[model samples]
Target: MLAKIEELLEQAKLAIDSATSVEVLYEAKVKFLGKQGSFSHLLKEMGKLTPDDRKTIGKRANEVRDILEGKYAVRENLLKDQELNSQLEAQKIDVTLPGVAPERGVLHPLWRVTKEMCEIFSRLGFSVRTGPHIEKDFYNFDALNIPPDHASRDLQDTFYINDGVDRKPGDFSPWLLRTHTSPVQIRSMLTEKPPLRIVSPGGVYRSDSDMSHAPHFHQVEGLLIDQDVSMADLKGTLGFFAREFFGSEVEVRLRPSYFPFVEPGAELDASCPFCKSKGCGMCKGSGWIELGGCGMVHPLVFKQVEMEYPKWNGFAFGMGVDRMAVVKYGVSHIGLLTENDLRFLGQFRP
Candidate 1:
């Protein structure tokens, strides 16, 4: 029995050494250690032997089993490593081969327009500023002199957080997602002393949408405050911006418009670049494009900021970057801008 145990151990060692792969090594291990294996069969013969002979045979069997198991474990590890190395060598890479090129990403058209607008103002000595998307109604309406009963307060137009419950309809204290970037002007006034010149560029939310309008969009608002600023300064600044943005020959005009924040506001227009003032589909055959709204800051706005009403004056302007991108890129529908179709977006590369 001792000799037979020694033979089994030697066979297990040889099988383990000769195995070329982890799978073969595992099979050999099971053949030796499994339920019907040589080691198991030897243990089953223990009851047929005398007590003294059984003791000797069992001790020798255990010794051989331990040695075989230790050597099998080592060979299994070796075979696993060898198989991995073979795979690596077979799948070797060519270091000198041309590498695959990765697809490049670009800024969205709205973002590009926003950056251009900001850059235009930046060149005119206006630093960039931003404010919270959710804002107190005072900054959005009341501080800007908007009446509480105005149609703009209607649910169909504006996205009010609550029905002003527990506060009332006229309350402007609770925060809301701002409908426009005009609130940034209030934030700039409160945080900084006068002689401020800044352009705010970011996202704004509204409860309105159409072929040309979206519930969420980008805007760039310009604000400049000083002791002696006037409408002429506003006109000159806008004219320079239009020329720089739309080309040297483009014409700009302002028609009287109204806004709650500005006492004497006007809508700015630029001659259509596509038709060169001769009329086209982009300008709706009018040869001019409405760019944005601008006006002299109302005195009440100054009063809200405690800046001594009438002592300081400024101009504010809000322009839809989405609209500007449409005019610049000849985009027919605003939905095309928000859609994540790579084919449409890829056209605006850089």
Candidate 2:
């Protein structure tokens, strides 16, 4: 029985050493140490022997079993280490290879135009200002002289959040995503005294989306408040913008237009760069391209903010940054600016 136990131990040790993988080593271990295995069979046979012989056989069998278990554990761990090392060698990273070039990203068209517009205003002594996208109806509409059921309020086509504040259905309060940056004009007027000249640039939302319109777009609204601001000043300011933006040679004109927020408002136009007033596909046979809207601040707007001092007056102008960028960059569709197509966007190097 002692010789048999010794033989089994030698066979198991040989198999453990010769085994190419941990799986094979585990199977070999089970053959010797399992419940219906060699060691267990040896112990069962021990009961047939004399009590003294049984003690000798049982002790030898247990010793061999314990030794085999300990060796199997060591072999399994060593096999694991061997596999890890082999994987490490196979999947080695070559540090000597040339580094991949980091991809460069260009500014989005709207942002580019916004930056350019800000720079243009900055040159004219106007500081850049920003305000929240979410705003009260008073600042967005009422303070801008837009009445409750007026065309401008409906014209905004706004997006309002449901805060569950007590109000009738369809009777939304001041809370809404700002449809325009004109609200910043009220914010500025309320907070700061006159001689305020600022260009507010930010995201504005409307419940509108199409080929040329996005639900969320950008606008740079310029305000110049001081004594004796007029329509001519507004025209002059916008003309400067057009000239600086397009070229010193570009001509600008203002056609009479209306906004409920701005009394006697007009849409500014600039000659098409491509056709140069000779009529082209860009201009649709008209020499001019509609750029933006500008007008003197309405008296009701100042009254809404409770600015009683009549000496302060101003001209406010708003131009869609995306629209200007489209015209400037010769982008045919507004969707291209928002669409993150690598092939389409990669063309705008600057």
What lDDT, from 0 to 1, does candidate 2 have?
A: 0.85
How well does candidate 1 score on lDDT at residue 205? 91
* TM-score of each candidate structure, all chains considered together: 0.72, 0.71
Candidate 1 off by > 4 Å: 1-98, 163-173
Global lDDT of each candidate: 0.87, 0.85
For model 1, give the 10-residue run with minimal summed lDDT. 164-173
**What is candidate 2's lDDT per residue for 161-202, written digit by digit as tens?**
778789866577668999899888889889988898999999
RMSD vs true structure, all candidates: 7.4, 6.8
- Candidate 2 Cα errors over 4 Å, as ranges: 1-99, 152-156
User: What lDDT tens digits, residue by residue, belong to model 1 across residues 31-142?
Assistant: 9987888789878988999999998898888888888889988888887888889999999999999999999999988888999999989999999999989888888878
Task: Give the per-residue Cα lDDT of candidate 1 at 144.
Answer: 81
